[model samples]
Target: MPDRPATASLDNPRYYLQNFRSVLRWVAGHHADLLTPQEAVRLAQFEALPEGSQALLVRMVMRKGDQFRASKLSYTEIGPTTVALQPLVSQGWVDPQPTLSLAQLFALLTRAELVRSLQAPLAQAGLKRNATKQAMLQSLAEASPQPAPLAHWCPGIADTVVALRSGPLFQRLQLMFFGNLHQDWSEFVLAELGHQRYEKLSLLPQSRAFQHRSEVDSYLQMQACRDRLDAGEAPAAVWPDISRSQAPSPWLESRRARLLFSLGRMAERAGDSTLARQAYRLSTHREARLRRLRLEEQQGEAEQVFCLVSDALKAPANAAEQLGLVRIRQRLGRRLGKTLERLPRPAAIPEIELVLPRQDSVEMAVVAHLSRADAPVRYVENRLLNGLFALLCWPALYAPLPGAFFHPFHAAPADLDRDDFIARRQTLFDDCLATLGRDDYRECIYQRWEQKQGIACPFIHWPTLTRELLDLALGCIPAQDLQACFERLLADLRAHRSGLPDLIQFWPASSRYRLVEVKGPGDRLQDHQRRWLEFCLSRGIDVALCHVRWQASPTAECET
Candidate 1:
């Protein structure tokens, strides 16, 4: 027998087949203990097949559907289609005769093919030859015909359809390989074709995503629940599948928390406050407790709200949650007629009022108006801080810790946004951030900027991160201030990653900078943006809120 190809190359005619085999080998090697008896037997059976048969099976599996017409099964490298398929049929991997519903038949057959096959039915229904495929399907749907073999549906239509019986097995193997269903066979092809490049990490045998078989099962179950919720199923209907007991894994627990939070939001939208409260109470997601407090306050449960808010304020998850808890407590205090200690109000954001000629983008107008010879204003928004953090912390972010780097094609860690993301790599991140205290931090940033340029990162926008901007940022923004901003980002990556000021004005000569948030006519600061502005102001950062008004056009003025 030929040795399995060491690498997948697009130049090979059977690159997809090679990729599929690689996945099987990878899963068998890494997840052998997790495989069930049936899966083990199936894997052995698949290996026992001839090369052509294996290639044929893989080709069918990679395609969208399980069923395919023999005429469509034309791969030159796999030799004769029937010759390749015979072994698959003998091994029970492909069903030569399988039942398919009318819907399935409709999907398989073209409109013209349908008319030719179902001529009698169409004629009986008095439908025109020019009738749409949809019309024909709708007309036939009323008859409720039983599912039957393709031959029965389209008798002697010069075609044979075969169904691959092991799509679910392939799916399970893929989940084991990729650690998620969102990525599929294309990742291998993309990597081979040089469309995307990933960091090379030294993976140990124990570094696989799933330690126990139950994690795989739980992931699939959670995925199904999410799918049902997305398909417009009621929260109450999907609630039973959400396991009340927590999983031992932090990543799995995070998935459950996020799903519960989603279900709670859905319930709240549907006006099921009780169900929403139940979901929120059970969820360990950062926003869940705050949402629950808001709901309770709405339902006239002020005392309960106060108790929960007080407990939460003692050890709030992050700044956003802490800020929310304080507001809830203040409202409850007002209602309960009790004086409470208040958090010192953040200094008001300095405002700049601009009345300018109407422009398409208010931000650009502000940028044009604020630009000067020595002091240049650019629309940096959230990019500058995010890019710098990503560059400085590349090592920490891409650390090949177990359960983080499952595959070779990952753009970012699987748990980058998870609650324990920072906790897992605290030491590495601390080492990376410690540079901010020293002078070599600028060189470290520049080195990463050059070496890892254009590499896929969650935070870095390579297209917009120019050398001039980098120089300006390094010179103007103090290391202490960058450290503070980065610390806040690490504190709550998901919540604090966005809502930065729209623009930054830099005085490179003086090594000074000011971050500006722009608001157009009738626009107000969003809660998240306000939170960010408050954070900046509290840290003694130079930031301002700019409100712009559009001057009336000549035609508008004449009409008035």
Candidate 2:
């Protein structure tokens, strides 16, 4: 709860121990109500232990597995491993005589150690000392040994295997602190090494991810099922656990929707349409409704799909979904012999044909062919526009609203992808966008670009969006155009973030520019690219699709 102690400094060899202590304190302070009685007791016990014992235990918890060879568990800061492990052994936090299967035992010991330890078994099975680890294990397969203490397996070996009993408890605390299992202690190392730096945010008590213990348990449950699913388990096999793990929190509900959507897709791939439909119906994921409608349509249920699409059209989830729903509705209307109003056709995106000498990439070749002294072409792709938007709207994006950010390490808001993300900070975003009307907008963008350089952001790409590119864009592109593009981005951050034109040609002298989407000889426009191009066309922005053909060279006659 207080500032980190001097012992926690990065220069200290025991920094990891300090990090573990910080996490324990943070979890206890913010999530006190959510902690179980047993967890609270364990935390108190862990704190009461000798510092060396605590460090050793933290080291094992941070390691790859629960089991460790006593010989392998040496640390300079913790002094002698034996002395540090004594408190752990006394407190029953570690099992000195851990039961390990043959596989686990083989993983912990070297081949030479295996040969020396099982000499009698090897001799009985006609295996020599030169035998491989697998061969030695298989030779004793018929006389299958039950899992027992390391002593039972290798009594002659002086080393002991210590299994940390509190690994799972420590893991729960970690999950509560980070809000997910994917991010681990390595984040601290990254920050300390300056490979990654985060915005320092003032975290309030309620800024935490989970409001109740049930949400934490639900997240853990969903994560376990997700792990099982990722491990190639069938959807049907893991469905029951996921089904029972639903949470009322919107964030957890979003996770549930994603998991269910994945399960639905897996079920569909497995030829279980019934299960797939059920999963889709249960999910709140945006694509789930569209997928369900398409599946129903395939089954000759046009009327049902028609009704759903018509209702969905009244209040579409986002632009992408709205586009899909319109198409579905139009198709169903025609099939049902009902007349429906049609939307106006989008203006055609102008196309250009170029035959250029091959280069590293199609985009590079196109840039080479199109670029001139006065008009310079840069492969901005999605980076330039997204980067500019990120720079201008950095304040709104990183606003310390409740539940938006809980920790200092966040690259962006936690609710960036949430539905109400824009509405919650509409005024702030409007103010940011309002600057575009004045000359100060350029300075504002440049200031943030310089200030927040290399800080992790969802949209800003520091490596590619250089100052020259920013200056060229600001000089050439009109203020209203930037505002339009930024507004479209805010419309559906998830959908409109990508699929931008690959190259931008700047005519700085005349204050003009053109966006080009490059395509190779056989390539065609994709849906998202077309969507972006169409959006540009509707906004009166100059955009062109360039089709590149490789220029042929004359071959030498019959040298062979």
Candidate 3:
């Protein structure tokens, strides 16, 4: 017989082949539904292995289940048909499952193999609790009718058997184990397994079922109170009264405090000072114990409560309350300021100009129409013109821009003296207005402003030949262009600087950067403008867009 081939040795080939066949049979019988067609082929290949290797294959598959259960995978639904078979390859006990994607199977299999090895050390190190051990064994037995031979070698096997004999730990272990196993099986398995276990356990007649009716009612009431408060209603008023006929319990007192706080705020809104004070005082007294408890237990809530008390005291009619409120407010403000100071300051504004086209002709017409009815059109013009001038005079009103002259433009005069200067300024303003009205000019200005300066002009209004002209002229523009224009205007003023004292220093060397963009409500930046804004951002420029509503009201005194 050729001395019996070396490949067929009993210790190797025959042993491995027999084990492999057994594993194949076990898998087909227990997990046939879980295996894909491709996986089924791979499983068959393992079945063809020598008996010695077959035992290793069975161990590998079993390890995969143990690993899945260990990692809390049992919490998720796992179908029997989709059982991953790659754990065997990871153990070096079997060749890689050839019919399945190697990468997909490697992770799961590797985890299982590693966990199996770790389990021995973990148990020996006393990391595996007796209850955990029992739960694991019970899950194993339930999963497979006959435990694999490898189970005998597990370090905690004896301890697990002892635990299964009795006690609360045993029951808990059984619940956790089966809970996880059912999760591995299917979604319906959890409910089914739970029901079966309940019936079996119920036979003991000593097991107590949990009741949640009172707990659920408490939660519902709390939620309803929160909902009422969120909707800006007084929760105490909206919630059913539970305090009048009965002495207040801790719960009722807490509810009362919350209600009182809500009522205080409502009273304050309604301008009922006496009622508001009464409500706030009631809340403070009712929550006194809660305040003390919070001080001892919750630092955050204690501080908040202190703040609320202080605020109430500050406005309190009595001297004692006022003093207390003042001190508390000051302390809180100091702490808040200290914390705020630790935060980083905003970035400095970069030198840039945002330009938008002038569109004030129609607006100017409306102003002119409204002013035309008035005896003095010049007064209306002067009011509008002065408003623009006042804005330029205050550089701080518009930020990020270093000065008001950040945009290259000149303001219309409060009053023009020389016909020559007036004509020149009027012409310049008209040219800008006319150009802004044209689509091409408007689009170009819009794109240029957005890209270079990051601004967009949506619509135009005209105040007059003067006010509208000044507004358009003073609006956003490229910084370099603004500088050039300022220089030219200054030169022009110096040459004709004699007659119009009002136009003195048209280009103030003290000029600071100021940029502002106005849009109607709901208006947003245009696409090209948005792109330009990105460009300005990349270059680090300061810009702001504001929605402005223009209204005529009694004018205030001028700053200068």
Candidate 4:
């Protein structure tokens, strides 16, 4: 207690101009009156401005009752007199005491280097004044000389200014700068000492612009798959591990399901029946959950069942729950017998087909046969059958496969030759049907398109159908052969001629080339298709789908 440190007083004139310079620096880009006495004192220490100079500067900038009032002025008369002398002290030329002239002050203030040197002290002095006054004083201290702009007091201070101006803080600083010049400058000085980036201060999470959960999940899954592939593991073996290892997140369920489905397709393509089966099984489970959610939504359930299912699926030891889930599905099927009956046969063979009974089921029967088939031929046959199946299921005006019906054809306009057109249309329909009934449906379909139009038909429009067919074919063929076939198809499409009809028939028997009229109604070809098709056609390849109109009913008049 006896050795308590003595507080420095502001009465000494030796430190007066130095303190004044400090206050001016603090107020440069901020308001003055907002500074508290304690803050002013801290700012003075921060800028290393002398105590007496800070007190003098504060008194000169702020009137009584302003922020600097708390630090009572010990040399009030001397404060204004020193401020008037500031210009002279800044120039290194001393102003004689009696005739302190404004011209001499101006001369002193105009020296750019001297003014910059004076910045540190002014900034410190500004901190001691009321927050508002301190800021004004700081700005005046840093003002540019008439001939040359004021040099930045610190080397990187310009960068800080640029950053502050470019950032969000610029607007706030501008407002504060022009508003109450005293308070804002003090706050700015405090902010600088705090090393805070005013622009980056955000309160809202939405402003962060983070990636969506699904996107991130999808990327991770792909990377994991690629990593596995790089490790030389078969695609089929890698999928299950990838799916099982996924992090639990409701928003990522759909992405996870898609990844699993892709892996299943890859396994099937590689002729890894066991691996393919596993992947498909995982995908089907996810699909089933999605279907259940859709059903619940339709029934107006209180909570979205899919969200709960996703949570359950993400739980530890998820595989153990499979048996219970299957039993639940069976019970549900029994309870909703009529509803189950009305459900359309899944267009593609699912991985879980073996688990279900195969009576009158298209996917199960096809997939079961595909698993037993061999090599390139098996792959080709599966693709052919699946493609036909897809066509049958598709609700087009004229479907080539059995069990498909054409919405009644409308008669052409009276100006056109209706009879001739009808005969041609009838022949085309008959040929398509005949191809479907052949023993080698794949060759037949390909032959029909190739013989007629010298081009392959569009398959991308129906991704689900393509995926299903590809999976089945992969089960039948060796992975290398399957990949080659896919490449062939892609190459053919790439080399096909432009303006060729949309549908092409490939008949291997009678003619190697034929045109099939195919159309993806309301579907636009993507950039990939356009480029591929253009390349193929440029290479004299025959493949194209022609745009066509179909009448709604037999009684409706035909427009084309």
TM-scores of all candidate predictions against the true structure = 0.90, 0.89, 0.16, 0.18
Q: Compared with the true structure, what per-residue lDDT tens digits does model 1 show for residues 157-246?
A: 999889999998898888877778898888888777677767776565666789999999998899999999999999999999999989
TM-score of 4: 0.18
**Residue range 459-535, candidate 4, lDDT tens digits:** 22233334334444323333233233333332222222122323223333333332222332354544334444443
Report the lDDT of model 2 for residue 377.
Answer: 99
Residue-by-residue lDDT tens digits, candidate 2, 1-560: 54421124588888998877877777888788988898899899999999999999988988998899999999888999999999999999999889998878988999998888888888999987888989887877778878878899999999999999997787788777777787787777777777887777767777788888888888888888898989899999998877544566888888899999999999999998888998998998888988887788778578877888888889887777788888888888899999998788777889898777766799998887788999999998999999999999988888888887765567888888777889999999999999999988999998998899899887977889888888899899999999999999988888899999999999999999999999998899888888999999989999998988776753422110
TM-score of 1: 0.90
The CA lDDT of each predicted structure is 0.88, 0.86, 0.33, 0.35
The per-prediction tally of clashing pairs is: 0, 0, 35, 99
| Model 4 lDDT at residue 310 | 40
Give candidate 1's root-mean-square deviation (CA, Å): 3.5
Ten contiguous residues minimizing lDDT sum, candidate 3? 198-207
Query: In model 1, which runs have C-alpha deviations exceeding 4 angstroms?
Result: 1-7, 115-145, 332-344, 357-360, 554-560
Model 3 / residue 61 / CA error / Å: 37
Q: Order the numbered candidates by TM-score, best leading.
A: 1, 2, 4, 3
Q: How accurate is candidate 4 locally (lDDT)?
A: 0.35
